[model samples]
Target: MSPSPSSRFRQQLIVAPAVLGLALVAACSNSSSSTGGGGGGSATLAGDCAEYQPYAGHSGTTVTMFASILSPESDSLQQSWAKFSSCTGIKISYEGSNDFESQLPVRVNGGQAPDLAIIPQPGLLAQMVKTGQVKKPDATTVANENKWSPVWKTYGSVDGVFYAAPMSANMKSLVWYSPSAFKKAGYQVPTTWADLMKLSDTIAKSGTNGSKPWCGGIGSGTATGWPATDWLEEVVLGGQGGDVYDQWVSHKIKFSDPQITGAMQTVANWMQNPAWVNGGFGDVKSIATTTFQDAGGPILTGKCWMLQQASFYEAQWPKGTKVGPDGDVYAFHLPAVNPAIPNPVEGGGEFVTAFSDRPEVRAVQDYLSTAAWADSRIKVPNATGWVSANQGVDKSLYTDPIDQLSAAELTDPTATFRFDASDMMPAAVGSGQEWKSLTAWFAEGQSIQQTARDIDSAWPQ
Candidate 1:
């Protein structure tokens, strides 16, 4: 039996943080204990800022934001609201991502919609637009804030109207390794694709002594093949560059294109080999945590040498593990596959969506766009691994060294920061067909040609 995409997403969600729920609710309640004296007991409207204007005015309204229940990354949104409330006098509430997705359609159909929402799934957002359930965000609202990354703006748009602004971004092109193991083995960090393969080959040939080189796990309950897809995407983007990658994601190019085929071949060659993945590639289908926790295992237990995953993996490292004078884990930029096609980084972002149309909802949005809101809520006491989307906040606010690295990577012009291709695409393609197709390739030993054909056939053409 294989894990389903929904179950995988759920598993990933569970391990991640849902800290936003409590913070959002607290921001809405008019208790001086939480709010303190700021913005005259409310967030100031856009006109008040002079730099930006409020989207709409519902001076005393309360809006509920639907977010992912498993998102620890949402603390930034809560902080934004707290600042919004202090600057303007609006209150905001937030719900889990799944809860909001399930309830949004019902509420919109029932005339009980929230003024705003922040759906993690782009397809759902598109559907809302199709049904006239969402309003296009005013361009001016996000003009000053580079909240909409070029790629996201395209996917989140329908009929040329942008619906949401990207709140925070994730980095996926990171390969974490046990520095100690690498040093002991006399292995140097690979700077190019050829060197990367050579490194993997060396690790594979070397019998597992204290460290295995790869922590490949495709198991996440329902979303079984996602890890495989990540491998495919990273390799393809690194080898083919952004243009070809974009074409495939947008259905402009076939999944079976030579570029994509080569990418899958690379993954198959690496993963199918005996030494590349600990417990063998066969074990990928059964390992839990999507091998996320395992990524740190090689270094932590000295069993594996490296794990390629997003920066979020830093949070999953065993608490109290020591890496050096610093913590136990660290991440390196995914090495460039070719100098021609820069190594593109993969990530996810959160947005604020509205389910209501009151003045307060507008006030909350306006408040969120301010610096004070970003500083207080985002710089939460224990949250060391989060970043704010608002470009105005201080970089020092990001306490986690890994997060700081992710932030730095995001700003590089040579690197293309693309959302997880599967996550950004329509759910039918991303979660349904893509998951099934890729997992079948890995688990059932399906042909690369067949896998690519299957994916193209399943695409929403």
Candidate 2:
């Protein structure tokens, strides 16, 4: 699947202030009244970064940022930054690298840090805080964070201090399917895990031209096994409950712990069985070679019944693919595992941090955390994929129905939200061994116990 809409990146551009002002007026006219940080008020419009506009005289100033955003996401961000620059006169020099997690420390340790950085993994953010290279967020930024659920503050906090502000959020509890095919087969959407399995079994027994019940892939270049890790994390959220999942992510419990191993087993039961997955790719091992971006392709061709992925997967569909409840392709929440457990959401987003305490940089940081920035970001033509967890962002601002639905899911008070657990682990384990072991489990035929043991061994002291 495409990376979460909240992935961070940097770019530098300037827009005509007058044009931006007009855009802001138009957006404001179309905006909803859900003041994000401020109390109940109209949503912010582009160039409506009311609190930070005082820094407009800082036009010559530039804030450098480092992040993992690139390509299409970079294009969207640049479009958003142009307006911010025009409104505040502070330029942004953004740089996105795939190796951001590995390279950020080198830059900081070498005393070559940027003015700010958009960090995607809190574990890496914590590591930077330990080195004293990161600074605490300003009060205004803190207030913006507080406007959202306490979860945003918790994600950006370390040692009881909030240092980063939430930038973007993606929903991860979706199961993508072909609505037309389901209708043709007279199947209803499943509401619980048991129902989902029963539906899978029914699909398999129906002999729909010998197609598998599911399609999956874990390949992502060096990030190959990350998707499988997501599956296990989601299972843990429902199968074992959030508190235990939290302990596992903090490494308070070993990877070989029954709670974790059982989750992994749950994933294997679907992924390892030929009747359940790799519908178009032939066998389970093919999942290792099939790119995640193309993994859900079989759903359109009716070769696979479902593909569990995040809301961001909407962008990967071929052009003209319908994505609403009645569209050619659509998504539903992966059903709850237990009635007693509140619905759990597994997702990720970027966090904003600063290396410089200069007024201009601080102003830019404050603006980004507010509803104004979200409005400006969404107004950009290339940002159709964007979604904000900020309570202030209006549903009307989202052009895509899927984005709106995802945003609703993120802001749902009844749902439990947790960041991707692998991202919260030490880099050596989260991005390294977890990726390797999960890949080996499915592709190399490693036993579940051995896979769990291998990951546990890779954990740091």
- Among these predictions, the greatest lDDT belongs to 2
Clash numbers, per candidate: 42, 2
Residue-level lDDT tens digits of model 1 in 297-411: 5557666667777665555566565433134566677776766765577665555555444455544554554455556654666554445545566777776677788777766
Q: What lDDT would candidate 2 get against the real structure?
A: 0.75
lDDT of 2 at 94: 76
The 10 consecutive residues of candidate 2 with the worst lDDT sum are: 9-18
Residue 244: error of model 1 in Å? Answer: 0.9
Clashes of 1: 42
Candidate number with greatest TM-score: 2
> Candidate 2 on 1-461: residue-level lDDT in tens?
12332232212122212123335333223133342221213333333544443444454566788776665566577677665665454667777765566678889999999888888777777888988978887888888876677878887888778888988888888899988999999999999899998998888787467588889887765567778888888888877778898899888988888888877778888778767778877788988887777889999988898998887667678777877888998888887676567888877877889988887788778888988788878887735556888888776889777787788888887887788888788777887798798899888899999999999898888
Cα RMSDs, all models: 5.8, 6.5
Error of 1 at 327 (Å): 4.2
Q: In model 2, which runs have C-alpha deviations exceeding 4 angstroms?
A: 1-52, 207-210
